[model samples]
Target: MHTQVAIIGAGPAGLLLSQLLQGAGIDCVVLERHDRAYVESRIRAGILEQITVDLLARVGVDARMRREGLPHDGFNLAVDGSTFRIDMTGLTAGSKVMVYGQTEVTHDLIEACLERNTPLVFEAQDVALHDIESDRPFVTFTKDGQARRLDCDFIAGCDGFHGVSRRSIPEERLAAFERVYPFGWLGILADVPPCGEELTYSNHERGFALASMRSPTRSRYYVQCGLDERLEDWPDERIWDELATRLGPEAASHMTRGPSIEKSIAPLRSFVCETMRHGRLFLAGDAAHIVPPTGAKGLNLAASDVAILSDALIRWYGEGEACGLDGYARRALARVWKAERFSWWFTGLTHRFPDMDSFARKMQLAELDYIRGSRAAQTTLAENYVGLPLA
Candidate 1:
């Protein structure tokens, strides 16, 4: 089999790239290790930056999102017990974000790809790349006991942080930096009304908590826990009690607890690769960087990465220009580092540290206080939260 681009991993990055490339009349095939149901059902982040929403709409896969997705103009930041709201839309010149689940976004893209008869191979096993440094590179994999080889001019490593894509690159040429926080987020998804219409992040003496939703009635909540904590340690009642305490009386009173549909513990980590491109293999999304979910930049950054990559590939295929491809690493890394900084800063601002001194605690509260009263500070946050420009 031969194609212009052979994409690994059918996650958002790969799926969205296929959609964009097809629109440009580029021939590509997507290889996914997981089946259809698993890819669409996995729970992930839901925050959509303005550019992400716009890109989805541009690709004609946001009809469901537009109908079901909630639009948020602001979000609440709580310190100790008092909460201050940041008006993202107002502060960022009418830019707003959409609160739509990432699973739903993937589902929409899958449906679009199916409807268009795009080439997306699922359940692909033992995928490996060869001759990536040469003009002709091909991928080999097994599907249903039969070995297969696909030839392509370029390869996109959209297979995520743990997938084979990043590992495929030579270690000496690629430098990776990572920081694992001492805490993890114990999260639960329940069929209950959310605490508020807008998302709220709270910092408390006990820890940190966030009240969010996939929809009006489907709530997703998270509370900070020690690195050693497990899902078994957090029952529904205890989780509810901790959320109520951390969110305080005003926000907690409105929170309705219910049976959890999903429960998991995700450790927070800040990671980034020194380079995103190695010869013909280019990394996007989790393959290139990871940010603490506090800032909601993971998927958005992926969308941005592929957007640059897609544009580059489109130029090469359509206009015969490869400058974007040559400059892909430099361009994507510039934005990736900014997101890394923001996620790290926001995570530190809200999470409780076991080794934090009294002075450090006081400083956290002081910064929160300043952020609440300072318009300049609020504007700076709004700009980052809504997302920086892709170019």
Candidate 2:
């Protein structure tokens, strides 16, 4: 197969790129290792930054989201049983986040692609990207155990962190930055109703906990755990007990035990590749960078990448201009680093550090307190939460 662009991975980045490119009258093919069910069912981030919501609306993928997604004016920070709300709307002039799961967004995009007859190949395996330095870079893969190759003018390495796309570039030409936190989040999804109107981040001596929800009937929560903590070690009672302590006794009545749809431990980390493009191959989404879930920036960042990349490809194909393509990496990195810093700051504030002295702990608390009381601090958090307007 030959095309103008060959996009690896069917995640948010690849699918959204295909949609955007199609809108601009550009041709592209997408390859996915997972089946439709697996890709749509994988639960991930839930918060959509304001910029992300606007982009999705512009791309005609906001109907169901507008119907089902919850819009929150702000969030709460709880410490020592005292909860303080940051009014994002008041700070950002009506900007607010949409609470919709990454899975839902992926499903919507994939469905939209199918409806529009976009080219997407599922269950493609052994995907190998090659010849990035040449104008005719390509990807080789297997479909139903049959070998095939896709020749393209450019390759989008949107296959994510563990995929072969990132590693395809020679190590000597790549620079990496990474920071792994000492803790991980044990996240759970239950059928119970949510305890709060908006999400809450709690800081306690025991650990950090997050209270989030998908819908009125579905609640999602997470608790800080050791990196190697086992799922078997956390029974239903134990999970609820810890949640009660961290979220406080006020929310206990709304918490009801239900079928656990998902359970996994996600280690916190901040990672960025020095460059997002190597000749004809361009990296996007998790393939290029990762941020901890504290700031809810992961999926939003991926969407932002696709928005920028699609515009660059449009410029290249429509006007025969490569300048946009050439500067893609630099433009993306600026926003990536900003998000990395914000995620790290939020994570550091909520999670306990063994190295933190009494003074450090007090300082952290004071900062949180100040953020709750000060309009300037709230505006800073609101801007970061809603995302710095996409470059």
* Model 1 C-alpha lDDT per residue in residues 67-166, reported as the tens digit of each score: 9999999999988778889999899889989999999999999999999999999999999989877899899999998999999999999999998878
- Compute each candidate's TM-score over C-alphas: 0.99, 0.98
lDDT of 2 by residue, 153-228 (tens): 9999899999888898999889999998888999999888888999989998888989999988999999999988
Against the reference, the lDDT scores of all candidates come to 0.92, 0.89
Model 1 / residue 65 / CA error / Å = 0.6
The residue pairs in collision within model 1 are none
The lowest-lDDT stretch of 10 consecutive residues in candidate 2 is 248-257
Query: Candidate 2, which segments miss by more than 4 Å at Cα?
Result: none
**Residue 41 local lDDT, model 1:** 91
- Best-fitting candidate, scored by TM-score: 1
lDDT of 1 at 293: 96
